[model samples]
Target: MNSAFSYNFPALRGVQGGKEYFVVMVPLRLIPKIFLFDEEEIPPEHRSQRILNKSRVPDITNYMLENSKEYVFSSLTASIDGQIEFQSFSDNPNFKDLGNLIVSLDSKFLINDGQHRRAAIEEALKISPELGEETISVVFYHDYGLSNSQQIFADLNRHAVNTTSSIGILYDHRDQLAMLTKEIIAETPLLERYTDKERVSLSKNSPKLFALNHIFNTNQKLLGKKKGEFISEQEKTFLKDFWFSLIGSMTEWKQVLDKELNPRELRANFIVGHGVFLEAIGVVGNYLFYNYPSDWNKYIEKLSTIDWNRSNRKDWMGRAYGQTGRINKTNQTITLTANLIKRKLTLPLTEQEEEMENLLKQGV
Candidate 1:
């Protein structure tokens, strides 16, 4: 069958875990009949062709006019070509004139993968609903499963930059944190001495560490297993905000550490004490904001006194290694510690800090 008229298969299909190549192929007549778009799936770009900022390529309209006549889709079985072939109707208005094209199929392809190609084709069909163009090159295998396909997906997606994934959201939120810090520093340029990385690091200290350490040390919770993976994304967001808020409250505390506390020595102390503190930060932080606000900073400062170079006693039956969990607990604990340090250094706490401390103590 011709490639152009072959797309009319059932929209959904399933594959098993075995290894086999099903001779699934497209028929010519079904291609033109396939509807590319519905109401909501609008095309994203005006032109299908990408603009080449550093190259001499003309704009989309001129590029299409000059090259459309020579364009050809490659066969699925042919040697792999690096060129990008599929383009939307809006990208090159002349894409419609190209007749049916052949494509090979792969066993484990998903709609999420073909979104762009599908979008372009759909837009073209919308503009000229009656116009007939059929067949697309597809190849398929049966029983060929996900592990093999994951590599293809990863390779195709290596440079794709997933802006929608949970990690992406975290990264973007970090940027927002940086921006907010910049705004704060504009008002008080004293913080300009700290790099973005430094500011982010300082913002993460909170007192939940003390509570979590007590729980873990008492064998009340286990953070090492593959448990709690479901809320991982939400936990991350919570952590980001918790850290940012703590860091934002640290202006006076930072000054005290700079003057009397020795940040380098204090940080070394934090890194060492984290093993016992990890559980507290993740488990207790959420509740303690209103539960133990009064002495949270004081507890952070106390915990920071634990010497990292000397302490190696295991916390969970020697079940875990490294200090990540402990270091991770520092956000809330350290925030509390910084506040205490400020008190000792004659820096009065802000009204927000005082109110927060009260709410935390009351578990409000």
Candidate 2:
């Protein structure tokens, strides 16, 4: 009865930078009502935070809608712009931080860092109202001023670094492509020794040949399945066979697996040892898999006939290496490299590849 007509939350108080802040678990249903978002045009310098990117909202909403039952959101940082009252349950110092926070209905609540999440939650609730029953934690700071709020937003984002793709794939259990990639690396005689599981870019002297996410992405191109899509045993067997036969045909990779060649030396000397080639192989393998299933291995065997030496400028200049002589990693380069590999393997190029090849010949 006491909670009516006002915003009341059971909160845990904490101190940061000598200022009191509170953490509260807010119900999704109350989110849109309690926090305010203004879409009206405001200059960036005057606003408390950057403008809401409307483009990012739908994707976030879809993710929440798809995984409403299991989705996780980190704590939203917000600023309460009114004098809110906090009542402690006990006078004991140990219990002083446990309290009820009450704010007048007229108080202004502004999100400092999670506007996208707030927007997504609102959209998700519209479609899956049951999701509104769940809660998201919000860390509330007493608003000093708009400048302070802007500073808070800056502080929150300034230190943020995105989780690396390789580590994310390594830790993901729900993503089928990641799982299959991990399984293949764990089991494959060639990849097991040379796969870097956590980092995307291998150090110049590192023994590892490729990163985990690169392998996962190559699998994505190889299988053309949605993220987290289920894999049939037959499909899994075919992928295993295809990759095994493909790698077996690469003599240098075998030499590395057999410790006859240093991984760094191979990565330095040939396009075959670069991760881009894995993607190119995946592209070529994907075309062969769906188009010429019975003869894919036969074509893959022809991989051995291609000279992969980085010095082969006629074959590799614009495809595997840039005009600057550095290895190329762009999607365009990967496609061009795949097209060259397809030709060497006596496989017909797809129309798209042929067009790209024509453009390459035209020096475009």
- Most accurate candidate by TM-score: 2
Candidate 2 colliding pairs: none
Model 2 Cα lDDT, one tens digit per residue, 50-76: 788989999889878877667789999
Q: Clashes in each model (backbone N, CA, C under 3 Å)?
A: 43, 0
Q: Give candidate 1's TM-score.
A: 0.29
Off by over 4 Å in 2: 1-5, 38-40, 54-59, 62-69
Tens digit of lDDT per residue, candidate 1, span 225-266? Answer: 221123244333444444444444444335433565444444
- The local distance difference test score of model 1 is 0.34
Q: Candidates' TM-scores?
A: 0.29, 0.93
Model 1: weakest 10-residue lDDT segment is 75-84
What overall lDDT goes with each candidate model? 0.34, 0.86
Q: Pick the candidate with the highest lDDT.
A: 2
Show the lowest summed lDDT stretch of 10 residues, model 2.
1-10
